[model samples]
Target: MTVLNEPATLLNGSAWTSHVFLGEWTPGSGGDYAVVEPATGKELARLGSATPGDVGRATARAVDAQRAWAAAGYQERAAVLRRAGALWEEHAAEIEEWIVREAGSVPPKAALEVRTAAQECYEAAALASHPVGEVLRSEQPRLSYSQRVPAGVVGVIAPFNFPLILAIRSVAPALALGNAVVLKPDPRTAVCGGVAIARIFEAAGLPAGLLSVLPGGADAGEALITDPAVRIIAFTGSTRAGRAVARLAGEHLKRVHLELGGNSALIVMADVDVARAASAGAFGSFTHQGQICMATGRHLVDRRIADDYVAALAERANRLPVGDPSGGQVALGPIIDVRQRDNVHRLVTASVDAGARLAAGGTYEDLFYRPTVLADVPLEAPAYAEEVFGPVAPVVAFDTADEAVALAADSEYGLSLGILSGDGLKALELAGRIPSGAVHINDQTVSDEAVIPFGGTGLSGNGSRMGGIAHNLEAYTETRWVTAQSELPEYPY
Candidate 1:
C-alpha cells in the first residue's frame, strides 16, 4: 500500500479546498457538507455545497466562456486535452487514493478508474483532429457540405460508482469538441469526480470558466438541466433519476444523453468448464462490490451443469475478503453508504424468503458486505427481478437455449449481456437474439474501452453512446448544412 495524500495537496497545491470549483474555489451558498469515508464512517473533510443559484452562475460563466473556447483552433484544443490526459497519468497514484477514500473503491478498481479516465482524455483528444463532416452532392449546381459545430454549454451529472470514468467520458469529449461544461457530481464522491477533474484541466491550460465543478445535490442538478444556457445534458445514474432528467430536458427541448441503471444477465452453457465459467460469473457480479451499472444481476445457467456451477461460484464467493479498502488490501470494500447497504440487504433477505437458496453469504459487518451467492432463485424473486447493485449473485437454471434466451431477455434493462459457451459461433448466435447495448461472448458483463461505443437500449440509455470519434462528435456537436456558389443562386423571381 502507498501513503495517501490529501486531496487539497494533490489538486496542484492550490487553495481549492472548497467544494465548488466554479472558475475558482469559492464558498457556495448551499452551506457545507461533510465528505465522509464510507469504509470507516468518519468525516474526511468539510466542503461548501453548491446551491441552485450557484448552478445558474456556473452556467452563465460557461456560456460566456464557450464562445472563446469554440473559436480556438483545433490543435490548441487538442493540446489542452492531451495535456490533461498526461496529467491524469502523472497523478494516478494520488487520484487512486482519493477514489479509495472518497468513492470506497478497492485499490485495483481505483487504479482502473484513473487509467480509464486518462484513456478517455487521450481518445477525446483525437476527436479534435477527426473529420468533422461530409461533403454532399447538391442538385442546384452548388457545392454543399455539412459541418459539426459545438453545442455551447453542456451540463453533466454523474453518479458515485466509477465516478471519474463516467464523468470524464462526457467531459473530455465535450471539451475536445469545443463545448464548455457545467458538472454536478454526486456529493459522496465529489472530491474524486469533480475537483480532481477541474484540477487536471486547470493545470492543462484550460481557460477559466470553460469548466465548472459544482459538488451539489438534486437541486443543483435540476438547475443545471433547466438552465437555458445549457444546450446539452449528459447524465449517468439510476433509471428513476434518468427519467426525471430526460423529462426535464425534453421539456426544455435540449439534447440529452443518458447512461442509466441496468439489471444485466450472464448466460452459462453446459459445454464450457464449470469452474472457469463460475470464475467469470464471480468477476462479473462481484467486482467493485457489484456497484457498476453493467454488473451481472442474474445468472442463467444450463440445467445440466447448474448445480456444479453454483457450488463453484459459492466457493469463490466464500473465500473473498471483505473489509475497509483504506485499511489494507481486500477483495471487496464497503458499500457507498448505509442507504445503499440497507437496500442491498433488503433485496437479499426478500429473495431468500421468496425461496432462493442462500448458497454462500447473506451477511455484513457495517458497510462491508460479504460476497453472496443465491442458487435456485425464482424468476419472481426480488433480488433476481431487480437490480441488486451489490455483491449478490442470483443463479437460475434454464433447460434449453430457448429458455436461456427467454430468461436473459426478461429484464426491462437492456444494458449489457454475457454468453459463455465453448462454441464461438453458438455464442455469437445467442448474442444476436439478445437486444443489449453491449454483448460479451465468452466474457463477463463488466467491460469498457476508450474507443468503443458504450451505452444501452430500452431503460439502459437513450440510444446515445459516449465513446468512439463519431459518437462523441454526434453527442457534443450538431450538424449544419453549408453551401457555396461563386455567385447568388438563380431563382424564379
Candidate 2:
C-alpha cells in the first residue's frame, strides 16, 4: 500500500497531527494554538490545547490502562514494542520531515533523531521479557525475593530540542515496563513528538488508553506534573523548568526524573592534532544549531595551541552553510523561535562586551544565527558561565592541566565533557577529575547512545539517569520484597 520513493504518499491529511487520548484523535477542549516553522517563519500547524480537566481525564484513563497493560505479561508487551520499532523504521522519512519542519533541525540532525528513536524502541523491546526480580538469601526456612513492578502512571514532559529522540528515550522504556504514559510534548514540535509517536504505537497494537499525547505550553505541563494519579514524572528541559517540575512533583511526593540543561566543555591538550580537535569541536558546538544540552559551550584549550585551534575552529564555523532546513543542504538551521534566537543574540552581545573577542561570527538573519566562536573569554562572561544553547563556542586558554580540569569543573551544569589528547592516560586522568555525567576521551562533548546511562549531575539533573537499563530502575518501576515462610516464627507481636 506504499511506494518506496514517494514521500508525499505518507503525508496525507492530518495524518501527522497528534492530539490523542484513549486511542482516538479527540479534539482538545481548551484553548487553540498555532506553531510557526522557524525555517520559513510560516505557520506550520494550528492545534488544540489541553486544560486541567483534560489532564484529569487522561490521568484516570492512564490509571485504568496501566493496570490492564501490566497484567498482559512481558511477552505481549514485547511483541507490541517490537512492532512499534518496525513501524518507526518504515515511517522514518516522514518522521524526519516532521522533525525538520517542527523543530528547525537540519537534515542530518533530523535523520539522527528519527534513527535514534527507532533504535530506542527496539532496545526497549529486548528488555521486555528480561529478568526483573532477584532472589535473596534467608537464614530461616523461608524464601525471599524482590521484584520490580510497574509504577502506576508516568508523565513524560519533553523539550523542543531533540523532541523525538528525547521523548522516545523515556517513552519506550516506560511502555516496555508496563506503565501507562501521559506524554506532554513541547508545543513547538508537537507534530513529531506527539502525533508521529502516538500514531506509530497505536498502529503497532498498543492497547487503547495506554499512551496519551497532549501538546501544549506550560499550563499543560503543570497539569500533567501535578496530577494525583500520575505516580512518576520524567522531564527533559532547561534547568529552570526542571526545577519547577521538581518542586511541583515534590508537593505531590511523586517520583521525578529530570535531564536538565548543560554547559559542557571541550578540552584540547597540547599533544593532540589541532586540526582534528578543531573539527571535532566545531561539530560538538554547532550540531543541531547547538540546541543540544550536551553541545560544547566552552572550549578550554592548552595555551600553547589555543591560537591555532581557535583559528581552525573558526574556519570550520565560518564555512558551514546556514539556511532553511527544508533545503536539506545546510549544516545549521534556524532557532526554535524568535525568543530563543534573541536570547542567543543577547548572550553573544554581552559576552563580546565583557572582553571576549568575536573570533568568527556574531550575526543572524531572521532566526538563523551563524556558528559563533569567541576567543579570550573571561570566566565571568555569560558565554563562559551559562548554557547558551545556541551555535556559540567561547574559547578559553588554560596554562596547566590543573587549570584545564578546574575550568571544566567550574560550570554549574555538569552534563557532559570532552577531552581530546594524544596521550590516552592524560585524557583519562583529566576525565577522572571532571564532575560530569559523561566524559568522552578523544571525542566531542555531543555524544549519546541508546544503551548508556545518559544524564547529568548538579543542576543538569536531579540524580536520575535518562537512558539505558539503569534508568528503568528509577523511572518505570518500583521494587517490592516478598517472603514465603514454611513454618511460623515468633515475632515481637
Root-mean-square deviation of each candidate, in angstroms?
Answer: 3.2, 2.7
lDDT of each: 0.91, 0.86
lDDT of 2 by residue, 1-493 (tens): 1112323333343743434454567777675677778899788776667777777788898898789889987888888888778777888888888788889988788889888888898889887887888999988688999999999889999989999998999889999998999998888888788777877787777887889888866887888988888989999999998889999999999999989999999999999999999999999999999999999989999999999998999999999999998975899999988899899999999999999999988999999999999999989999889999999999999999999999999878899999999898878987998899999999999989888888899999987886777666556899999999877898998
> How far out, in Å, is residue 274 in model 2?
0.8
Residues 1-493, model 1: lDDT tens digits? 1112323345542456555888888888888888899999888777679999999888889888889989988888998888889889888988899899998999999999999999999988899888998999998878899999999999999999999999999999999999999988899998899888988887788888999999888888888999999999999999999999999999999999999999999999999999999999999999999999999999999999999999999999999999888888798999999999999999999999999999998999999999999999989999999998999999999999999999888778999999999998999998898889999999989999989999999999999988999899999998999999888866799
Taking all chains together, the TM-score of candidate 2 against the true structure is 0.96
Query: Could you tell me the TM-score of candidate 1?
Result: 0.97
TM-score of each: 0.97, 0.96
Give per-candidate clash totals: 0, 1
Candidate 1 deviant stretches above 4 angstroms:
1-9, 12-14
Please provide the root mean square deviation of candidate 1 (C-alpha atoms, Å). 3.2
